[model samples]
Target: MTRNIWTFITCGLLFSAAAVHAQSADIIISKGTDKTTIDASPFGASDPAGRMFIQVLTADLVRSGWFARGAQGASEYILSGSAGGGGGFVAQCRVAARGRSGTVFDRSYRGDANEVRRLAHEAADDILKALTGRDGMASARIALVGTLSGHKELYMADADGQGLVQLTGHKSVSITPSWHPDGDRLYYTSYAKGFPAIYELNLRGGSIDRVANYAGLNTGGVVSPDGRWMAMILSRDGNPELYVRRMPNGDPVRLTSTRRSAEASPTWSPDSRQIAFVSDMSGRPQVYVVGREGGQPRRLTLRGSENVSPDWGPNGLIAYSSRIGGRYQVCVLDPRSGDVKQITAPDADYEDPSWAPDSRHIAATRSIAYRSSVYLLDTLGDPPVALIDQKGDWTAPAWSPGR
Candidate 1:
């Protein structure tokens, strides 16, 4: 397998070999920020599924960046939970503050026996919100393209990259997956019909619907946050230009009219009024923003020689991969002041940044030579952490809006 890291997102690549390995899901926000201590234990670290539950809960709390681990006597909050059952998976958790005698948080979760990890994640997130008043994304799902089976296919997994299941077995080429507002379906480009076209897959019902299959090229279909509109790249009108339609049934409104330049990877603003995309209009690809109502496009990135894969977050920050010092690194841009910051280390290649629901962290594909994996990058300056250690190339991660 050759390592074509730069053009992996634009042109799909396939790799051989597959292996199942679970890595620690621990993620910390930053070192200096004050994090309250909350401990969850006394269940079973040596037990079968109980151990799995504890590992997941510890990872979720530490990853949220709001809490830290403490000793039993010095901890600010103590959390006790039950995570074992003979039949169906059931979890019950309760939290109590140090000074208060009454329990501050109490909740129980029930799901299938195979969904124990998910139940644990939900419990951790619910307790996080109750104690810190901050939104938790432990239960968030990630949709990405993987070449594990020696063919390009769409795959999905939990935020920690567990319980990965293939979504599209087209056995052909499928890439560029985007989630709908409801999170029950995905909008992606596939060659199942022997042509590059856009389709939507319902996660629940397994129904695939074709969204766009224009003449020349049809790819990069992303729905707006509000779900009323969709922005995509189409070459039906000649050189691939940015197009927006009213979603279910509306006319395509062309946004860019460049003659020879190409446009790809369209992302929506939190308000769904503006769109940030990648365009090679200036002889080099850079991040650009255009209105959904169709207007003149404006370049948004000036610091990098090459920038691509712009993901606009709810906190008004756009994350993209920038070519810094001849290497692709993760960089975030404040579209307001034109300020740019590089968050990934410049030692390896990283691209296709998708912001998490909280906007405090990003999910992106980090490639070190021919191997690639999905990693979570903290916007607050913590070192990059791999969300999964499973073998095979995992690229183009799209994070769901934490449910």
Candidate 2:
């Protein structure tokens, strides 16, 4: 009898261990689709007075919008980070919802003392993606052309519409500013040469260099995330067609073949593997995506009469302006599942929907009731918030990736 009881107890212990292991595996597998409820608090890492790491981590997490910041009550998740001695810091996070622990997401990183802020953001992003299966957008910036005082010039602003600064001093119209992957420079179409031309403007030096000059039209340019190639629309070949050019040296390589369709408003995928742009190949202007290396093109937009200004975000989501219900409105598309969601209704001619760095918000110019203004719509939120009020017209608002 004693031997039998001991055997039973051992078997029960083994079963419990196996169950725990299985639960852990399930959590790991389902993490990508799970939305975690979390709380962030200070974990004992260094001196009590040292909270710089926590500050930076919280800022980064808030900017990412992956989690709803907890106030005081019970939180679904908890995050804590500290910069301790020995030039190393530890960021530990726990996610819990209702009564279940989501996952054990933690990391310890070591780097130069001056890189603490960058490291902090990186650590926060890792924790966020590990727990929530989404990357943080705290380190991205946006480039767009803002019109002021009857002059259209290039302007760079933060993703939240703050810190607006004019990038180009040209009196002519400048539009379609694309940022290099490093966020150190901007390439835009400036009319300084009597026609739309590509110009590379250094953000650090406030210097501008002409990149591509064509006779007919050169506009709607975008740079690859790797900064190796550029995609733009150039009418130099008699009509607007997609063209790819090598950066810094400005070696041109035409990507499209026919003048049957006007290809413009090119936006690159986050991985730099594909390019999405507006084309009239399907008898009308619609959004189409093609491989970067040149191949067959696939149409994405079909429900709308006309769709233009496609902007690809971090995830597989694409934002564009569509003529729905007799007016131009902003719409979003899930490229993976073919799910289309109309964001802006038929009240105004809303165009140029630029995705925020977080991939959760879109910045666009909306014209309603004979007035135009800049608006920021948090796709994950209930609705959008007006960021700027304009009297005449505020068009082409781009959210900066980050500083």
Candidate 3:
């Protein structure tokens, strides 16, 4: 979307200054040849706000969890993009540490002005990928709750936890902002009028539409990759049970027929042909996967008090958050072999694990010192590191598909 003038000013006065200062700081790479010192070279564009725009772009890049902090300072390969005068064409620019001066990578695109930010993001993603031979995080978004005036609301933030945009400002509790495969809209649960219901909020139109309204419970809704259906938990059938509903029109196709055990946290497999959900049918909450057509379910995790929010990763891996030793932490499992591996050893409760679109990083919400925040855990790295600090309570982190 075309950023408001106020948004520009806020970025200029706040994050821009930080970016300039951060440029002087060192950039660390867990897996790299060596750290390089480069600059966020100047950009000449018709738009007078190019500096501030670049700062905001840098901030966006750093927040993706792919780039190191103070990126502008250590960017041996400088890159830039700008919106033109008519707001129609975006002039792209880049300079790499090729030999003398640098090698330049430049391009232009004729599109909507709102695409300016997207173009910048695309440029950053390209640069990062070319450098590391791995994917970047610029294309991700964060899902959290935004409370105002004692009302709990739903929000979607940039991957860095900035650009906090409220998706639902209902005068009630609205939590669990999940993303569709397209990333243009958000699916969340809201208690706007007292009863909890699932709603879809469109980011472009700022409109909220109810997706499901059952008699007892309607929560933990996650859409499949094909965008054809949503796997959620509902109590309309009598007790809390897992259900799959067609999108656009809430026509639920019950997946589980059990009434004795409560089932929730239904996550879809990457192929969209199966669903991994949590069921107490085994006496406690455990991870189980069943075919979309409904058949025999194979249990996954066998440790901890309860294993919830089982998200299927890109490959043959399933990640879930389980309460271990009275504290919740994230763990990974091989659905076929039933092999389990603990990824997060956080001293506090760490729940709601959302796998990054790259399948390399897992973002989760952890409770520390009575407050909650989001942490990014690298599957191949050391441990989980907090991404969003103790500023505000953040939960229900749903990573957007690579944009």
Candidate 4:
């Protein structure tokens, strides 16, 4: 069977001119020489759900690039929590720094039994914020299309690959699941009507609606950060090209005009001014960027045999899958300096890298022996770890932006 090219999947500040410059100059970059060690104490020993919370919290912290799990000996921070209740589980969490000697985070979360994991994730994120002065991805989720039930279906899971829920029951073929910045909605392509069309799934209410149903192709729909524009691929005019359409309902403004070549995988820059997409106009598919208002497109990747699945991150970096030698690997490119860094090893093929909101980790599909599973790669130092232990052919992993 031929590999499906599309199936491989897939900021900003303001300030015055001179006053902003002075403030930016005052910003200091901190360079750390050692990883922060954290000891995560078991949550509720008597409650089964509480124990589950503890397990997930520890795993989430370990997966975070800034922290490591270990004993309290010589530990920089300690996280302890408890969960229990009769009608609903209540989690009381506390985090403290060893040297500072005061409680850094203390809070209580109350919800149904099913919310134990979510409460734990919230505590983990809070701990991260208290320690690193940055947000955490523990509470975030990932959207993907998998073949677990023998058909391509849309599924959503926690960032750690737990709480798997099928978003779409199309049971036909769904691909390219893209999350809105709010993380409550998703846009993807499905063949439920026997033709490729883009559909939006409201995760909160479980409502599905078709967003784009043009004549030819309606795939690779990516909603901008502002939720005002959607950059997608539509071939209604002639050849497959990149186009940006207004949210809800609006005619698309074509961005690419190559008459013979095709384009796929459109992504938006942090400021939503430019879009990075895949194009074959140069004979072989390569990554290219174009303005949202429809202008000339400039090629971005020049060294890879084939470059596709461009994901513009919140940190001003673009992550894509590049074919090196004979295997596909995840590569990050600095659009400003044209510097490229390959993040995956040569032993396995990794594809469809989606950046975590923190911009320090990426979730991608690692394939071996025709079996594919999602793996999270920390951009800093740790080795890639499997996102889930389930058996399935997972692809097109999209990490949710921070809530």
Q: What do the candidate models score in CA lDDT, each in turn?
A: 0.81, 0.68, 0.69, 0.81
lDDT per residue as tens, model 1, 148-243? 877789999888888888898899999988999889989999999998999999999999998898888999999998999989899998889999
Backbone clashes in candidate 4 total 0
Q: Residue 333 in model 1: shift from native, Å?
A: 1.1
TM-score of each: 0.89, 0.69, 0.78, 0.89
Query: Residues 272-360, candidate 2, lDDT per residue (tens digit)?
Result: 88899888988899998888888878888766579898989876689999886588877677776555555654456888998876577
Rank the candidate models, highest lDDT first. 4, 1, 3, 2
Looking at model 1, which ten-residue stretch has the lowest summed lDDT? 12-21
Which sections of candidate 2 miss by over 4 Å? 1-134, 389-392
- Output candidate 3 Cα RMSD: 11.3
lDDT of 3: 0.69
Give lDDT for model 1.
0.81
Give residue 129's error in model 2 in angstroms: 6.9
Tens digits of lDDT, candidate 4, 134-195: 88899999998788888999888988898998888888999999988888899999999999
Candidate 4 ranges beyond 4 A from true positions? 1-33, 42-44
